[model samples]
Target: MKNLVFNKLEPGTNIPYELLLLADETVEAINQYIFDCAVYLLNDGLQNIAVMALHPNSNTELEIKNIAVIESYRSQGIGSILMGKAKEIAKENSCTILTVGTSDTGFQQIRFYEKNGFVKKGIRKDFFTDNYPFPIYENGLQMRDMIILSHDLSE
Candidate 1:
């Protein structure tokens, strides 16, 4: 973890737009949080490898708006690092729960969150079809619902 450096990106400044698009498909989708939410960029000193966007939903909860690691740098424990950082931040802010929503078809993402201590709580049906202008696909399956997962920060 010490090898990874995290920085809170400043608004109205340089944001890795291309890197963000890797996690969220549409520019319109990213526009929902890119400007207002807090964006954290993780770099390995050599390159900007990952980014996570956080949105504080309430005094006791926060949502992971977006979390993505570069294609080549994935599966290398980077996403976990970002998650840990998010947990730490939630604790500091006195938030009790950290939540994330992903496509129902995102099997890898579901596994990833569960492995990191998050549990499935609820789901939003037709989230993708209703939000995006076009259909979204993952693993050859058309994404239709959003699976909501949460972890207790107090634990």
Candidate 2:
């Protein structure tokens, strides 16, 4: 974890307002509690991505709240590495699970999480309706819900 750099995006600066509309307090609290948001620079051997706001869900679970990678640096397995690190940290702490929420804007992320072995557990209806500037769409379909995805670290 020491080698990874975590950066917090300014409350309303880095993240889209639509996202904040739904989870502002959660983000605020995470910014205050987490030591750092992890980032892997692009200049350093082709790995440029950031993972931020890791927080404890409880004694047995940890949440991966935010992850971002530069568009040019994406699809090169950087995200997988970040998720691996999160899993490692959770396992080290005896955490049983890892959880993350994806907005309707997180179109590609939905598949990424499932590809990494995460399963859908629930949904928040109309989650991004008020947050995204434009309507959210998936496969030409409008997204009107937020899905909760989880991976079991203990298994």
Best by lDDT: 1
Q: Can you write out model 1's per-residue Cα lDDT over 1-155, one digit (the tens) per residue? A: 46778999987777678888988988789988877678999998898899999999999998998999999888989999999999999999999999999999999999999999999999999999999989888999999999999998787
Give the residue spans of candidate 2 off by over 4 A. 1-48, 130-143
User: How does residue 83 of candidate 1 score in lDDT?
Assistant: 94
Candidate RMSDs in order: 1.2, 6.4
Counting clashing residue pairs in each candidate, in order, gives 0, 5
lDDT of 2 by residue, 19-95 (tens): 32232334443444444433222233333244444678788988776665555546887678778777887898789
lDDT minimum window of 10 residues, candidate 2: 39-48
Q: lDDT (CA) for every model shown?
A: 0.91, 0.63
